[model samples]
Target chain A: DQQVKQNSPSLSVQEGRISILNCDYTNSMFDYFLWYKKYPAEGPTFLISISSIKDKNEDGRFTVFLNKSAKHLSLHIVPSQPGDSAVYFCAARRTSGSRLTFGEGTQLTVNP
Target chain B: DTAVSQTPKYLVTQMGNDKSIKCEQNLGHDTMYWYKQDSKKFLKIMFSYNNKELIINETVPNRFSPKSPDKAHLNLHINSLELGDSAVYFCASSQVRDITDTQYFGPGTRLTVL
Candidate 1:
């Protein structure tokens, strides 16, 4: 079963615009959420993360908002750049921090 | 320097063959993990080793095994490989500081079983 889901398979946004990618989870036991950026022929790199205690987390031009009531989360990249065009994966950590469940990635294309 | 590295970036072998993939991390992290990405681009965790000890072993078949000789190295071995096992395998590591530590991933190893 897919506990985490990224409904949008692909997203296109103009450069310098705001790009919002959405994710939904069915499990309430997940306390930690993370976003990773992946490029072609390369491994995914950790981008940003949010804890259950906080509703939002921001790093540089990237921001993540979590809605515990709705079991939803989103990653927003303001002033999105062409370099940010890649696959974005939403991951969740259950009670066991050692293991993580990942969602099917969303391919984002930032047109310059 | 590459914090995490995996050898034989691409491997193509016949069914029933035995092969191994080596992974190493120079970041001095205590935890290492192995993940597989399928054709549909779904990434799933396979196994994890912390400080050279097996910590998490997913519902993978016994034909697949992970070996960690030290804290900085974790390797995956598959015996009697099947066509369904063809996928991209990634090696990752994270520090044991906070429960939400960030994981660093290495360039994935693509294995094609024919």
Candidate 2:
């Protein structure tokens, strides 16, 4: 069973525009959510995260918003740059455990 | 300095062969984990070790095993590898924390079994 799902396999946007990526999860037990950016032949790096207690978390140009009722979360990047072109994976951790469950990942392409 | 490193980035072997992948982290984290990414690009946790002790073992087959001699080192061994075992394995580590969950991952080891 896929607890976490990224419905969009790929998304394209123009540079300097706002890019939004969405993720959904069925496990309401998850209290911690994270986003990771990965490049080809490289490991995924932590981008940002939000807790169940908070609805939103922002870091630099990236912001993550969580809706507990909808069991959905989104990542928004302002003024998207070509450097932001990479696969984004949404991950979640249950309240009682630290083990993370990840989504299939969404490939973002920022065209210059 | 690489925070998490996995050796033999690329490996190709026969179905009945045995192989081992070594992993090391220099971040001084006490928790380490192994993740497997299949052809469909689904990342699944295989095992987790904290302070050199096995903490989490998923529903993986007995042919796969994880050895952690120290907090900073974790290795995965496969015996009589099967074709379905071919996938990219990632090693990761994180500091001991109950609230803040942050993990660093290695480049990953791509294994192909014929």
**Top of the candidates by DockQ:** 1
Chain B TM-score, one value per candidate, order as shown: 0.98, 0.98
Off by over 4 Å in 2: A95-97
- Tell me how each candidate scores on DockQ against the true complex: 0.69, 0.64
lDDT of 1 by residue, A43-78 (tens): 999999999999999999999999999999999999
Give the distance in Å from residue B84's predicted Cα in candidate 2 to where it truly belongs.
0.6
Interface RMSD of 1: 1.6
The 0-to-1 C-alpha lDDT of every candidate, in the order given, reads 0.95, 0.95
True contacts kept of each: 0.62, 0.52
Candidate 1 global CA lDDT score: 0.95
For residue A44, give model 1's deviation from the true position in Å.
0.4
Give the Å error, residue A72, model 2: 0.5
Cα lDDT tens digits, model 1, B1-114, are 999999989999999999999999999999999999999999999999989989899999999999999999999999999999999999999987775788889999999999
Cα deviation at A102, candidate 2, in Å, is: 0.3
Per-residue lDDT tens digits of candidate 2, residues A13-105? 999999999999999999999999999999999999999999999999999999999999999999899999999999999843367899999
Clashes of each: 0, 0
In candidate 1, stretches whose alpha carbon ends up further than 4 angstroms from where it belongs are none
